[model samples]
Target: MLHSEFYLFEEEKPLRCTVRNYQENDFQELIAIQSECFPPPFPDELWWNVEQLSSHLIHFPEGAICVEVNGELAGSLTCLRISYDPAHPHHTWEEITDNGYISTHDENGNALYVVDISIRPKFRKLGLGKLLMQNAYYVVIELGLDRLLGGGRMPGYKKYAENLSPEEYLKHALSGKLKDPVITFLLRCARTPVTILPHYLEDEESLNHAVLMEWKNPFK
Candidate 1:
């Protein structure tokens, strides 16, 4: 795939950043950014190794993108194409990712599956997350995919797990009555919760649960 350099202008300081495809030299930097974004117990063990990351880049080069700001690796969004069946059962992150290599990726798949997205802590709340999501939308259009699907970890749902069901919590998040750091942002990006996934990941914040979300391609 042909990659292009895109710029983002922050309202306050007008920072110049480029969003582009991953390269061989970016592996270690991506790992470091992932570590800083997701602290310990956030399942760093499940992250991709050099070989695994290489496999993704080889199979679906355009699916993985990195953000550079002031010549620093700031964030990245990794995805894969898969044949989706709404009636088919949903798979866990490990199952779909093949432990991170995305061995099951289907080149002709009509749905784009987001595998992971990470932003450095120092760069959070700077509109980078939304920028990455917008880029994903363009990818869907570029590939002519039907929609983008992913399991969103409910980082704030654990607090009400005993009191409210995942569906109930999602309703609140969708309605703007509740503010969940992750889900709220996804909602703002036009992703709608489709279902609740139990035991999505072994993390305290998610309480082993996630929300299956989708953003249908408007251009499709």
Candidate 2:
């Protein structure tokens, strides 16, 4: 059999990612990649270009990783620190904006608020997701942060919106109610009982689909 034939059945090696600091040049690419991965993707020209600085992807401060395959950019992972309470002295919450509840710590005691990651479909399922998650987890651990939260899931709650029914398409589009059942089903399928937050993410539609898993994080 030719080497090409062997490639058909063999799984590709994981992407080669160089965890490095983001520069000014990497901003547009990041947004473009995000647009590809997410449904309500952020467009490239929207930000006055200078507004790109507000992007957490450019300032992982603690750190970030960009995967490159055969010298081509494949995807990226970002980290941000966020806080809900402004009075908190340790206020490093990236920016006070929507869903800015999660926080990421920077070397300078600043926080980064991250939300999107865009992995090329071809490079997925090869441990990239886990790699990105683990990297983010490490940042929090090294910083000794007790709280780690993100806007949506690892990759924004867009995929769950795909092919949603009209009933599922009510309030919050596909985030709350639709998100719960889908998550619950995934857990059940994994032989784990369906569990969820009591009030999923400030979205009322969540009530119809999720069981009250917990009212609070139980830590705070």
Candidate 3:
């Protein structure tokens, strides 16, 4: 299912790779990685929805990107456009209020929500995660978006071993599925909106925030 993508950024190898303005053409590639990384895997349709939303409402640099390693697609990130709206009072949302994810939203423009990013099995320890993130930081500049936000599940279970490398720890963590805390901490420290909500999965936090974010950052 892996095809050699003739990407414009293929020539650049500064330890980090970027996939700008992702579209339907990138759908299969994205799902390949998403299915590999996420458990219970989100429906394939979600990818289509994201692409539709981005194509319809996403603004400059507020789309998505993928990272390459050794000339192969290693990981991908989707930075979504989001914002706060007066119509929605997230003062009692679950993600912002509960489960402790950031709730802040950008008013003037939109925020970039780091939806998903995963490195292939062979690409760990290459400092790609941090590099991918640093690249996301530059996304704000590219999209002219003031702020970025997203929820990540942290590794609730981790066993650090002297013999194990950092990537080994990360791989263990990823296999254990601990990313929420990572996103929570980053959102808490970053300039994002704060809202209250119940368990993020069942609650309407993402929906509420999406409403606000979409309302402001709708298909441009």
- TM-score on alpha carbons, each prediction: 0.94, 0.50, 0.49
- Which residue pairs overlap in candidate 1's backbone? none
Any idea what lDDT model 1 has? 0.84
Q: All models: lDDT?
A: 0.84, 0.40, 0.43
The model with the greatest TM-score is 1
lDDT of 3 at 143: 65
Best by lDDT: 1
- Across 1-220, the per-residue lDDT of candidate 1 in tens digits comes to 5355655666656676888888889999988887887787787886657998899888898988888887788999989999989886467877877767988799999999989888888887677887888888899999899999988888998788888898899888877888998888888888988888887777788887888889999887
Clashing pairs in 2: 80-104, 80-112, 80-113, 81-103, 81-104, 81-112, 82-102, 82-103
Report the alpha-carbon TM-score of model 3 versus the true structure. Answer: 0.49
**Candidate 1 ranges with C-alpha deviation above 4 Å:** none
Candidate 2 TM-score, C-alpha based:
0.50
Candidates in order: C-alpha RMSD to true structure: 1.5, 10.0, 10.9
Which lDDT tens digits does candidate 3 get at residues 67-186?
665445777655544563445544332344222122222335455656555665555546456556656666666566645544443233223333544334345433654443343334
